[model samples]
Target: MQQIINFLIRNKTFITYLVLLFIALGLTFNAHSYHNTKFVNSANRITGGVYNTTDAISDYFHLKEYNEQLVKENRELRSKLFNTPASSTERAQLPPGDSLQERFKVYPATVIKNSYSKERNYLLVDRGSRDSVGQDMGVITSQGLVGIIENTSSGYATVQSILNTLSEINASVKNTNNFGSLRWDGNAPDVVQLVDILRAAPIKEGDTIITGGMSSIFPKGVPIGTIRDFTLDISENYYIINVALFNDMTTLDHVYIIENLDREEILNLENTTNEQ
Candidate 1:
């Protein structure tokens, strides 16, 4: 206590001067409108800058949550788009009296692992059987198809990427009955091959390709890729087409997994018919 009293007494003059200076400045600011206005403006600017910096930091931390919300909204929109009736821009025609109620269900997932540079490549996603994903379910992005679900656990699934040599999908040229089998040559990550497209269909360079809806996996009219080039096979009976994929397999992030509600019923009926 004596040391504190000694220090205060020694600095009394300086402390008095500082106190008087602050009082004088306050009186001056209050007495003059211009000084008061300037002080207020400076205070506001400092506070505003602090608020802006804090807001930016908050937004940065919430980016993942915002991204997930966007993914969910996109998934809902796609569900509506795929379950609608056939239109001129979509499918050529629909089966008579076919109601497309709940035809496809979409689930959003993130790619946990990806591979594109091999004869056989696969992807691991953050969805699983618990998310209603199953084997043979089609996986796609907003741009194009990714692959089919090969296996699944409770919390994860593996996709057989379209770049795999063993991957085969049913695809067709848009707005036509011309269909072919989509396959990968494992030569390029961005390109795949479509085989068995008959030459009778009107085909040209840069034509759009889409799912053929031949099977219960992918729905009709889902965009696949564009025709880069095409040539007739040895016998000239069919065209072997080189397709530039819409989805860059090397740069995958989020994907949607599709479940065909009628898949089980169709497979059961076909099996019964074959046994007869």
Candidate 2:
């Protein structure tokens, strides 16, 4: 205590000067409106900068969640685009002779896994037996045809991609309805081959191709793609069509699964007749 008192006594002059200086500065700012305003503005500027920095850091941390939200939104949009129902007006007014109509059920699912690099590509979907998904169900995206569901678990399903060598889609000409078989070349990821289409069937470069409705997999009139090019075979009976698929097989995301409601009954009926 005595040493502290001695030191205070030694620096009393300096301490008093420092005290007076601080008081003077305080009075100057308090007395002058301009100085007070300038001080307040400087304080606000510092606080705003701190707030913006914190906000930026928080936003950076939430990027992944935001991206997931975007993916979900995209999935919903595709669902709406592909699965539109019959409007009330359309349902009330059926054409007199529209008897051969086939209805399709669309089930929306997300791709949990995918493979494009392999010779026989397959995709894993986030829906399966629990969701009523089963073997032979067709899978497609907004852009175009995808594949068929080959295997299923309670909560997941695997699809045989259209890129697979063994994959086949019953297809037909869009307008003429002359049918053909769609197969993958196993070389090009984007290009597929359509065989058994007669050369004299009014085939053109931009002619549309769609599901043939001959099998239970895909319903009729589902747009597969358009003819990119074609060449007559050596036999010269049918044209080998090079199809440019509408879907970007490498960038697949949300897909719609199709269920043919009457498939089982129809198949059973056919099987019984064949047995008889």
Candidate 3:
């Protein structure tokens, strides 16, 4: 305590000057409108900067949650779009007492494994038989089609990717009758080939391609991709088309699985006819 008193006595002159300086500055700020205004502005800017920095940090940490929410919302929208009737004409064509419920069901799944650089690339999703996922269900992302479900276990499923050489899907030109089988050449990851479209079909480099909806898998008009290039076959009767996919195969994350309620009925009827 005596040491403290000695130190305070030694610095008394300097301490008195520092206190007077602060008092004078405060008096000037309070007495002068311009000084007060400048001080308030400076304080506001500092506070605002702090708040902005804090907000940015909070948002960065919440990105994964935001992405999951967006995926869930997209799943709901896809279910509504596929389940709803396509047009007024189709709605009118419904049988007299038919309900307006959608024929296709949609479920969201996350990709647990993916392969793009192989002759037969496959994807594994987090949903399986326990989630009601089964073989032959079509999978897609928000941008475009992905693949079809191949095998399923209790908690996981394998998807036959569109990039696989053995993969074949029924596809067609948007807003036209020209249709073909979509296949991959096992060479390019972003491009696929379409075969069996007639030469006379009106197609161009940028024409849009979509699901033909002839099968029991995908509903009609699900976007596939845009035509990048095409050429007439040696026979000159059909065109071999090169399509640029919309989805980046190397960066797949969330996907939707589509279950066609009428698939079994349709397949059974076709098989019966074949036997006859």
Return the top candidate by lDDT.
Answer: 3
TM-score of each: 0.67, 0.65, 0.68
Which stretches in model 2 have alpha-carbon errors above 4 Å? 1-88, 92-102
lDDT of each: 0.80, 0.77, 0.82
| Per-residue lDDT of model 1, residues 115-186, tens digit only | 898877877777777778888899998778999887676666778888987788999999899989999988
Clash pairs for candidate 2 = none
Candidate that would win on TM-score: 3
The total number of steric clashes, by the backbone 3 Å criterion, in model 1 comes to: 0
Give the per-residue lDDT digits (tens) of candidate 2, residues 56-159: 56557657855785687689888876676668446536774444434567899866566788777777776778888988899987667999987676666778
Cα deviation at 140, candidate 2, in Å, is 1.2
Q: Candidate 2, which ten residues in sequence have the lowest lDDT sum? A: 34-43
Q: Rank the candidates by TM-score, best first.
A: 3, 1, 2
- Residue 46 displacement (Å), model 1: 50
Ten contiguous residues minimizing lDDT sum, candidate 3: 34-43
Could you give the C-alpha RMSD of every candidate to the true structure, in order shown? 23.0, 25.0, 23.4
